[model samples]
Structure formats: structure tokens, C-alpha cells
Target: MTIPDTGLRTEPGSFRDPTNQVFHLGGDVLRGLDEQAARDYRTLAGTEFFRTLLAAGKVCGTEPVDPLPGVPWTTVLRHERIPFVSHPYEWSFGMLRDAALLHLEILRAALDHGFTLKDGSAYNVQWRGVEPVFIDVGSFEPVREGEPWAGYRQFCQTLLYPLLLQAHLGVDFQPWLRARVDGIEADQLRPLFRGVRRLLPGVPTHVHLHAAMQRRHATASTAAVRDQLRAAGYSRELALATVRGLTRLVERLDHPATESHWADYQRTCGYSAEDRAAKERFVEAALAAGPRPRLALDLGANDGRYARLAARLADQVVAVEQDPGVVDRLYRRLRADREGRVLPLVMDLADPSPGGGWRGVERASFTDRADADVVLALAVVHHLAIGRNVPLPEVVDCLVGLTRPGGRIVAEFVHPDDPMARRLSANKPVGLFPDYRTEVFERLLGARCRIVRRLDLPSGTRTLYLGIVGD
Candidate 1:
């Protein structure tokens, strides 16, 4: 939604650091960095630290971009755009912990290479598979001997504490973090996590200890705290050692709960013989009719059941789910299974990823990655329409938009008379899609897509409609 990525919005974005903003123009994204931050970015980009990261394959590729010839007081760096952007909160436990460790690793390396992270925010990292890659080149600043890790308390609260809370206390800290759009404050977690001896084994020492230590910084005079940090040996080597320690702790974290969807998929979805046969018939027919779609977006891919079926038709599927547990299982299966071609991602379609980064150039909005050859919205519209109260037509538009022109849309309709649909509308009958009935649906299809076929299942409640779009 920034100035450079899309022709959609060239408006300046709401981002921090006051030094830069991002704008979009078609496919290219532009960053607006202030003169001071631009200088810092140039120095950091020229440094061997970034070179080593690229050399080591730890980050997305970057190239120095020429400024708009007459643009004033800003520097531009063109980054190989990530197909989609996700946040630590949107990340599964494995993803969040991995990102936290990545932040520490990047900071450690930056220190060794004569630079330091200008900030420690969870927003700086993105995942390439399970690997957390650094996306912020401008966040690094040259460090001198006396300065404390300006990001110390920030790192502990942002990375270490939330992770420990999730791993040890079995809390889905994402909602808490999402509530506090900024990182989780240490004080909030400290009181909640205290007196839990049962959690001792999984609890990292850093979370509690760091919070206690940070209290002193807030309580003491700024001069006294800075002096104390210097006295306590907050040098470059110390930052590296601290970060390495956090990394080791993060690595040791397994998901706090072993009850994950993919691991338990067969158990939970042990669909009755009749149910399985019905769903399979619908999926197989859809796949057989469509051309091989190289990319597919699975809207509500709970444990990737139908998505996996459609994968029989696509080269890769980005399975989207808001449940971290489900996404964790999905990620593990995609990464570990030898037959894997799925990219499991955590996305709440209701509030998909939004724009961020200095001037918004740093991270692309979540919708930027919506392109797909076939879009599967199986058993998903119910949740969006009834659960999220989104209108059916709007939901249909969103799903259909994900596919290319002539791309296929696989949609499932649940009859209002069905028991499931009855329960979904228990609060109030918000009205069924009366206009999208047999006649209207066909006409709508004629306008936008050719209705290839409609499968009316033996069960009266369900139907699958496949349509190939028109130009």
C-alpha cells in the first residue's frame, strides 16, 4: 500500500523512525529514508556484515538503488521483494522463535562487523521456509564502545519474553502481542508468569531475569542507567554473547503444546467413510478438470485437507490459516515431508498482513502475494460470512481476485437449510445467498467466468462449483 510496490496507493505510509516512508508505483517499491538514516544505510550496506549475510544466504538479495533523480533527502535500496510479508505475531511458535533467534544472530554478526542494530523489533524478519531472513538493512548503525545495546531491553521484551511465555506458560501470546501492537512489554508478562514452578524446565532464565534487570533502567536516572550499563560491560562482545545465549534458548524451544493439526489431522479428520468419499469426489473432479496450476492459494486450509487434494493439480500451495497450531503442523509437514510442495503460512484473511517498514518500503502488505493460478475457497466462506460477518459477494470477490484471468475458482456452497448452516446462523438469519442460486450463479458466471460444471453431491447441503474465468 506504499508508494512503489503497486499503482494502488502512492500515499505516504504511517511508519516509525521518522526518517523514511515507502510508496508504490506498479511493481517496483520505493523507500523514503531521511538524510541521516540514508547515510547510516549506505555505511551499513557497504559493510562486510551485509555482504557476509548475502554470501551466507541468510537474507534476501539487495542492490543499491538510484534515488529518483530529483528526490530530496532520501536514499533508496532495492530489495528483492518477498512474495508476501508476515509478522512475528502471525508466525507459528517455530517461526516466531526462529525469527527471534535470527534477530539475535544478525545483531551478533553486526557487532562483530563493527555495527549494531539501531532497533530490536520483531517486525524486521521474514521467513523463507522455516528459515528467518533479515529484511532490514537500514536498521543497523555503527556502534562505539560506550553505548549500551540501545536495543537491549527492547530485545528481551520483544523476543525473549514473549517466546518464553509461549513455550513455558502455554499461552498463545499472539493475541496478547496483537492487542499490544507494539511488542509485548516485559512487565505485563512478568506478573502473569511468576510463581509457575511447573513451567521451570521450559522457562528461559532470560525472560524473568531480563525483566527484573530492565526494571532498574526504568527506575534509575538515565545517566545512572547508562553508567550502570557501561559498568556492567555492555560492549560489542557482550552483545554478541547475549544474543548467542538467546539463540540457544530459542533453539531449545519446541512448541509448548504437541497437539498440532497436521500431527493430529488423521486423528481429528478421521472422516467417516461416507464423508471422505463425498469430499474426495468433489476435490478429484475439480483437480481433473483444471489445468495444472503452478500456484494455488488455499483460503482456509485447516490441516491442508482439500488444499492437499488440490495440490494434486498445483506445483505449490500456500496454505493459509489463522490458528498457529494448525499453521505449525502445516509448516512442519511442508518442510519435512519428502512429497512436500506446500508453503504453509499463518494468515487471518479477515485482517491480512498490512504495510510496514521505513516509509513502508521495508515490508510489502500481505495482499501483495495474492497471485495464484487456482484459488480454493473450500468450506471457508461460511466462516467468513457467518463467523466474521463478511458479506458473501465480497468474500467471493476476494477469492476470485487471487486467481489470474481464466484461472479457476473452486467454491463450495452450503445450503441454509442444512443443520451446519442452521447452527452457523443461530444468532440471527443474516439471509442466505438467494441471488446466487442456481440461475443467478450461472448468469454471474457467464459475465465473469465460464461455469465449467457444478457438482451436486448426494448430500443435499453441499455443492461444488468450478468456473473458468473470462477475459
Candidate 2:
């Protein structure tokens, strides 16, 4: 027998679901299923129930793929790939809230038709254009009474608790979710107790109640307690009502924050007329680098200024930012006009998503998305290398790895004595980066790509470097 198509570049978070495995096939997505799950998939694909949801535009439509006869019982039915893979951590408070609401809505719809979803992870729901689509069909199992929804606590932890963290404490838990995929635990909430109890109602309910329940269950019999709650008339309908109430808590807890930089991005922007002209000229020259990419990854896309420029030239642009407020601003702008092909997301560059699954073969990582023809690293090196404590050579290695053989990289270097660099000097980056001179950077970059162009910014301190790999 020939080997299976077991090649993967990166891993995604939601690969642990027991029913079916999601994988990438020649850049397309395919799901492998067991006998039982395959039967459910076949049953669901032909049903009026699924068709109703698809027609209602509540979920993505599933096209049936018949496997070859006598292929292994564990074979996959290839399917059409989704255009985007979104993480709950990348979502806004409203986006996450809406996802929670949509999850409950989909589950309730499923329950109405005498079916039950085995899972309720927020990671399973992805946005299609402007709507959330439940893509995990294998998660649906037959519904029965007196059995608690297995994903209830997950719904609370992943969606409910983190959202409450944002509202009650004004802390966007998106960053926290990246490291801990299942989301924060209760003990983690102990520190957030100060103002949350006094100011927010929903925060107290979801956070305190959920945490308390988790701590209590550390030694107590959970099955007995669950059975008790079930016998106490907490049926699926009643449980769903409680879930709806918990979702409403987000409305009461809704308080968007305006943090440093994003709140006054336009005001604090130090771009002079000449500086703007020089930067735009650099970008214009960078955009002209060959056939143009269908996908572009704009690292450090602050408020989407450069991403908007790149979006003009590409069909899809993934704008990555660590600051939620900036990402929020970028997302709001993108969502408001609906004119640009910009997908702004909040993600830390240093510790990005990784490949995950059985032996880690199914899902891809954040770095896999970095394989773009064009990568714009405008004014971003200081943050990743200096601010985040990554060494310069390693950073260069990452930038080079992202590009195609002839792909271009546009990066900015702020000198040690510059005013902006002076402000960041106290952060120990300058001490660690004593050897990172402009000439040294050019030499290292030249080793990987041809130094196509370099110029002094009108601001008089920073310089932009445009290079193409292997000449």
C-alpha cells in the first residue's frame, strides 16, 4: 500500500475533536472520518434540516463527497476548502459575543430537530463574509434527555469567561487564548476580581460562578452533581435558556476600551508631509515587485495604514497586530466600508499558532500563512526583535523563510540614536542590540536577497530597505 498524504506545514488548535480529523490536501481542506461519524455526515448532508440551515444562511453548506469503494474504513472524503480560518482570539469582543450567540443559535436549531452537537468550541465557528458558520459537522450526535451538553463549560470558558474579562476588566483575553487554546481557568480569574465584582453584573455571574463551580468540582463528584441538576428539571431546553441568558450578559458587560496608541493613532502619528511621501514612494516601489500576490501578510499592520495600501494590490491581505485596539480600529474600518480586501487580526508575532493533531499532522500554524509573495515589515522589526527580545539574526531568518525565491521584503530600520529609538532605548533592546548597525543589517539581508533599493526617510533618522531573495 502507498503512504497516506501525511504532509503538513503547520497545526491548528481544533484538531482534538474525537469524531473526524481536519487536514490540508494540496492547499485544500479535507476531513477524515470514522465509521460512525461518516454515517452521521452522510445522514446530515442529505437531510432537510441541514438544507434549512444552509438556506437560512445560518451555517455553511456541506457538499457530499463519496469515497472510493473499499478504500480503508478510516478514509477521507475530500471537500471544497474554506477561504478563511479564524480564531476566537482574533475576534473582537462583539465578534466573540456574536459567535457565542450564533453557537447557541445553531445548537438550539439542532436540538429542535432531535439532534445534539457533541462540542461547542468557539474555534469551530468561522465567519463566512460577514456571518459565523458552524463548520464542525462531525460534532453533531443524536440528542437525548437528562444528559448535560458536554460543551457547556467549554462555552463558558472559551466564550463566556474571556469576554467577561474584556468587559469587566477592560482586558482583551485574545492574547491569553493564543498560549492556552482551551482558554483561561478559574484561578486565573482570581486576580481579575478587584473591580469586576463592583462594576459588572455579567462578569460576576459567568466568571465567579464558573470559577466557583470549577474549584468545587476539583474534589466533588461531578457526575452525581450533573445528574442532580438534570433531575432538577435542567433539561436541554432549560439549559439552552441559561446559555441564552449568559450570552445576554455580554450585552450588560459591553464596554469597549480605548488604550494607548489606537485611541489617538491619528493624533500621535508623527508622519510629516515629506515622511508620508517618502513612505508612500517606498510602498509604491514595493508593490511593483512582480506579478502581485493573491495573498499578502502585513506584519505589524498598525491601524491598517500600510495594509490598506497593500490591500489595493492584492485579493486577500492578512493584517497581523498584537495590539487589540489597533486591530479593533483596523477591523472596524474594514467592516465599515467593506471596500478593502483586508482581514485584520490580533496575534502576537513571537509565539504564533502551531501545527496540531494526532502526531501533529492535521492543522497548520500561523507561520504557514506567512508564505506570501510579498511581506511588508514596515516599522515592525523594533517590536519583534528589540521589544519582544528576539535576536536580529533569528528575525532575519524568519523574514527570509516567508518569501518565495524571488519574493520581496520591505523593512524599516530605526538607528540607535533616533528619537523613536531613544524612547525605546530604556527597554534594554539597545543594550542587547549594540551590534545591529545599518550597514550590518544590509550585509546580512544581502546574503539572502538582492538589495534592490534603500533610501533615507525625510524624517532624517530611519531608513527603508527593499530587497528581493536570491537576486
- The C-alpha local distance difference test score for the whole of candidate 2 amounts to 0.71
Report the C-alpha lDDT of model 1 over 287-324, residue by residue, as the tens digit: 66757886778887877877777777777677788787
Candidate 2 TM-score, true structure as reference = 0.83
lDDT of 1: 0.68
Candidate models: Cα lDDT each: 0.68, 0.71
- Candidate 2: Cα lDDT at 357: 39
- After TM-score superposition, the amount by which residue 29's alpha carbon in candidate 2 deviates from its true location, in angstroms, is 1.2
List ranges where model 1 is wrong by over 4 Å: 1-14, 18-23, 32-49, 73-75, 197-209, 212-215, 219-224, 256-295, 305-316, 338-342, 347-373, 382-407, 414-450, 457-461, 468-471
TM-score for each model = 0.77, 0.83
- Candidate 2 wrongly placed segments (more than 4 Å): 1-15, 47-49, 52-61, 68-86, 90-92, 127-132, 187-199, 203-230, 262-269, 350-365, 384-391, 426-434
Residue 368 of model 1 has an lDDT of 63
| Residue pairs of candidate 2 with colliding backbone atoms | 10-355, 10-363, 10-364, 10-365, 11-354, 11-355, 11-356, 11-363, 11-364, 11-365
Error of 1 at 355 (Å): 8.4
